[model samples]
Target: MTIDRCHQVLTAIDKINQQDPNKININGEMIAKELIYGHQMTACLNKYWPTANEYLQIAVRAQHVKRWHIARSTYPEGKQGYLTWRKDLGKMHAELAKDVMLDCQYNNEEAEKTASIIRKEKLKRNQDSQILEDVACLVFLQHYFEPFAVKHNDEKVISILQKTWKKMSAQGHEIALSLQLPEHLAALVSKALS
Candidate 1:
């Protein structure tokens, strides 16, 4: 949001102009902040209970990190490795969620229960839409900024994707509704009182 951060993010991105750079480190924090502040995540996430912003913050940060790892990671592409990574992602996210909930003063039992649901939802995403999410992310990136077209030699493609994501949209959320996200994503669109 800050102009300095905006430039820092772009410059970080500029470095990996060659291929897929590990963008998570550079963009994850900012994107996490954007999602929080832009979505009014404080309001949306707080519906479940008081002091819920912390929960959303941790999950958002964790999700951004997980995606960064998946996209930029160099592990041999295989069914088992991908599945393991997916499970690990879910576990880490849930743990982060639990930490936030407990910090917000929720009892350990309640926090654990909430984190369990989060974990389940996270895994369900791997099952129902991970591929869709991946494709959608790539397509959106290509369409708006064409970062991959930078001709990465694989080493820098991750960087390209990361930088492109930050540079393409800060508060300009219109593309997300119509981009690669499922039809459900569009439901977030506002229908003013008529």
Candidate 2:
């Protein structure tokens, strides 16, 4: 019964993400990026932490639920604006996940757990939150980093990679090392690490 309820909640979260108007081209198919991103989060969690509990699983899946609704443009420009946007997004994601959990009949404790994970509370000190951060960083490295690198100067890209590396655990670093990044990108990552 608990497992069934969790599935229902995940389905509901996925359904909400499916309604996103913004789309990305994947494999010659136009699909909602957030929806695919949710799936990616789940996959990464399973790969990194196969024994993850239902709360962690659900938290990973809803990390970016309806993220596009809050446009980056709504915030000011520059580094401060970027930081502010990220902070607000974390809070918003937590609130949205809480509502979904409550709607799914999850108790307060369970809902709060999910919210904390979404908000990345106690990231380094909290094991579960750190796991989530690892998965998020891995996802960013695998899918978004290349495009992000193209837009930024090499120095900036290296700085971002170094920051991402710091967020991940040793296990995440091992997994990241195993990924087959493009030659140039791999060199940049190596440079950043060195």
Candidate 3:
């Protein structure tokens, strides 16, 4: 079974509160600003918590999962293989967070807050992936393709990366609009392939 992040967050918060009275001092808007744990743990909590606060009874669940068994993907860590493995990490966290919320009855606001956190984290991770590729691509070009593109002082490789970025940025935006998870490139697989 998938672990729920909401429940875990609530548990962590409660545990912290029990340990120290001063930590839970802030309520309302300051509640979100409160820090509960270390880096990876915080990333986990934020990604799974939901946002609906008015009624406060939020339950976020991971109903389904889409996977990329193929092993190669666009970020060119060779396209499908490692890329899928990398995103699976986010899916695991998301599942954990959803379970946590279900146990706590944390309302829509809390659930949404968690979702927002995850989305933000996913974005950062995606950017990091691209940066890794961009750097490698740059070096590769410099050593090999640079001579061809640079003759007449042209930046063919650089321009290609820029254009590729334009497409990626647009794709990211579209997915955001549809509320698709950042790790959800699989949702666009057919289109991407075609």
Candidate 4:
């Protein structure tokens, strides 16, 4: 069944992500960072776009599948390096997700469809890809923004926020504005927007 295959693929992705050596503290408990990220992506998708198709759901959940495997330090320094690293990571995630889908018995077309979503092909032009991008932005705002802000100066943080904002949709902007961020972080977001 389609539902069963979807579950199988998701479970397989989770299994690989669980091997992440990095840990993050959530509510006083340490958890695998990427593993929690996958869950957060799913939570955001379910909350904002409950009727999302299985391919979108799988793409969102596998957005950062086994992300820690590629260390940012492995790439050259500066913006070009960062961009290259991100592009490579996207390809890696897509391939890994497609492999999982195929292993779960998904047809080649179905597997490629999900993989393309993971790669965020066509971004603004692809509805599913845009939704995945929105979910990722929302998750960053809700769970990761504050901590990230703390480590960077306001100017840098604002610049990063601006870049993140540019990648999101109007719907994503609305949801991001509705998040209950810490007061300082909220001020930074307002500053970034203004």
lDDT of 3 by residue, 88-124 (tens): 6445534445545646665655555554443334433
Q: Tell me how far the alpha carbon of residue 170 in candidate 1 is from the true structure, in angstroms, after superposition.
A: 26
RMSD of 4: 1.0
Q: After superposing candidate 4, which stretches have Cα over 4 Å from the reference?
A: 27-29
Model 4 gets an lDDT of: 0.94
Please give the RMSD to the true structure for each candidate, in Å.
13.2, 1.0, 15.9, 1.0
Cα lDDT listed for each candidate: 0.39, 0.91, 0.36, 0.94
Q: Pick the winner on TM-score between candidates 1 and 3.
A: 1
Candidate 2, residue 79: Cα displacement in angstroms equals 1.4
Give the lDDT of residue 46 in candidate 1.
Answer: 35
The Cα error of candidate 2 at residue 122, in Å, is 0.7
lDDT ranking from best candidate downward? 4, 2, 1, 3
Give candidate 2 misplaced runs (Cα > 4 Å): none
**Number of the predicted model whose TM-score against the real structure is largest:** 4
In order of TM-score, best first, we have 4, 2, 1, 3
Positional deviation of 76 in candidate 3, in angstroms? 13
